[model samples]
Target: PAASKNTIRVNSPRVRCDSASAEKKKIMCTEAEIEQKRLAALAKRRQREQEQQQQQKKR
Candidate 1:
């Protein structure tokens, strides 16, 4: 029975490893979200610049 308890103790680190991987996935998801938002904002700014240039040319 003591050997079984030792085996359980040895397996504890695997649980920690699983949680660490979960944390990494969460961080990667947030980073991807941030990148998507940045790209959208950049596209919006470029569109506005193009509209302004077109208006200036019309005048």
Candidate 2:
């Protein structure tokens, strides 16, 4: 099935690669794994915020 702009098509190469690397039919992360993931995600969000702030400053 094809996806709209907001969705990732499951069979797309990039999406398939990303999903395959990320999860192997698992739902629940272990507590440690969850915390690690949470921290990594928070770091990524902060990086994005910093980048956006820099962009806004430039504009």
Candidate 3:
């Protein structure tokens, strides 16, 4: 039987180990992107707050 959309049917008689499994491995891309975004956001927040505080002091 061929691999069906609804059900997975292994054509091979011998069960093979799923080593090329991207599912088992942790995806490193999105995590790094998220960290970078978070850092940029924090820096923006700090800069805005600092500018506001300086303005308040001047006034």
Q: Count the backbone clashes (under 3 Å) in each candidate.
A: 0, 0, 0
Return whichever of 1 and 3 wins on lDDT: 1
lDDT per residue for candidate 3 within 1-59, as digits (tens), equals 34473254453322344443443444566777888999999999999999999999999
lDDT for each of the candidates? 0.98, 0.77, 0.70
lDDT score, candidate 1, position 44: 100
User: In model 3, which range of ten residues has the least summed lDDT?
Assistant: 11-20
- Per-residue CA lDDT of model 1 for 10-53, tens digit only, reads 89988999999999999999999999999999999999999999
Candidate 2 per-residue lDDT, tens place, 4-39, comes to 643555347787777976675354456668989999
Q: Provide TM-scores for the models.
A: 0.79, 0.50, 0.57
**lDDT of model number 3:** 0.70
**Consecutive 10-residue window with the lowest summed lDDT within model 2:** 1-10
Q: Output the lDDT of residue 20, model 2.
A: 78
